[model samples]
Target: MTPVLDPDTSLWHVIALEVQRQRIAHDLSVTQLATRLRVDRSTVSRIEHGWRKLSPEQADGLDAMWDLQHLFRRLVRFAAATDDGNWFTGLMDFEKEASLHRMWEALLVPGLLQTPDYARAMISTKSADVEAGLETRLARQASVFDGERAPRVSVILNWAAIEQCVGGRDVMRGQLAHLLEMGERPNVNIRVMERDAGAHVGLDGSFRLLTISDREIAYSASPERGRLVLEASDVHDYAVRYDLISNLASPVGASRRLIEQALEA
Candidate 1:
């Protein structure tokens, strides 16, 4: 049986449900719908499950097929107009529930591994209440790192992020020391990607893949905002990217030595 999407989740969810409903009403199988859209079968599945956004072109194709007078295209525009500024908020909730986390950061320490001072230094530029945001970040770290039920975490961080001072020398030293300490935990693994490795796949950006309950979620962020990805195929791509990054990273022991070297330098 095909699962139904809860229409109230988001406008995209409503669009997905409508697409699925129209396809079924016209006696079309998923494969048939995919053929009509000139997209892969998996694309149709992702759309129906609200895991992927319906693209403008795909919406036009569907509207033409069903003679819906561009209804899907109009819905897509409306969904695009609404700013999902709460994506990071959603990420916080997912992080608390995730059982396994694989993260890759090219420029800075991952937030879960940041010292309060380091976190504050970055948060202060964007937030009106630095202390409040700092408190929330500390709480998030405690939830993921201090508890017995803490998730298994693997991090691949660029060496430059360790070498470059954040929050001045004292705070940078504390952050490095904190990373070394966190790396000692049995459930946490940290590896460093050397700057000398030339260019690599991770140079594009930072991303994290999390396993929550039994489902996988991926997140990629820019300075403006972050996006939460739920499509299985897209999440798998992130997993593969993580593996590629791990290949270029130093082993945990070597990474520890690198951190120790930076602390001394």
Candidate 2:
């Protein structure tokens, strides 16, 4: 079954209304629609009321039988993209809408840059459904970061994060190589901050700053919690800190050189 959509988003209302409109237009009662779709009447009722989820197969059946022009199929994707968590939804939405994105990492490779093996090793250890979380993250890279029109991106990695050996040797090497490959893209700038730089403003934490529409927002996540920075002052502070840390990190060319060196090791 597809996941429930966040009612906070207008898309949720649109989908519910669409389903109801289709049923009424066809002069079909909830029971008739449910029977036609081979689902329980309660399922059809829940879909119209936005209380339960409609499975993708069932949605496609609705679309095919009702001649929805693939509308339900598309709406199913929107519902699948959302879940019941505030932690990932906000930043993900910002990423979709943002034109520019910058991030710094002190402990582990940033999610956007991780290889599947590395990401699987990390996320599976934390979440109940490791495969689901891992695939979701990988899917985000394709949908949000891989295109030419994707957000102009920059990332600074602490030397320790690169050297810590999170997923063992082979996975780490693949990840490093992937970094160099992604860095070659015009829109992606990946850098490494040598521990030698020692004691910079970013010592406080890792944060991500994004340019959304005309405004800037920042986010910080820790093992304990995550924070969304909305105040202009706070967002500016992170941007300033990012600039300082980027200065400390090796420049793109030298950064790729560092990654190459690590790949050799």
| Best by the TM-score measure | 1
lDDT of 2 by residue, 1-265 (tens): 5455454664556677788888999999999998999989998888877776667798799889978776687566555654444445667656776788899988888888889999998987778898899888887787667656778988899887778787889999998888888898888888899879978888788889989767898998787567677669998988889989887888888888888988999
Candidate 1 residue spans exceeding 4 A from truth: 1-12, 15-84
Name the lDDT of candidate 2. 0.81
Which tens-of-lDDT digit does each residue in 43-139 have in candidate 1?
9999889788999899999999999976787577657754455567767766887899999998999999999999999898798999999999998
Cα lDDT, model 1, residue 169: 96
Q: Model 2 residue 196 lDDT?
A: 90
The C-alpha lDDT values of all candidates are 0.88, 0.81
Best by lDDT: 1
Q: lDDT for model 1, please.
A: 0.88
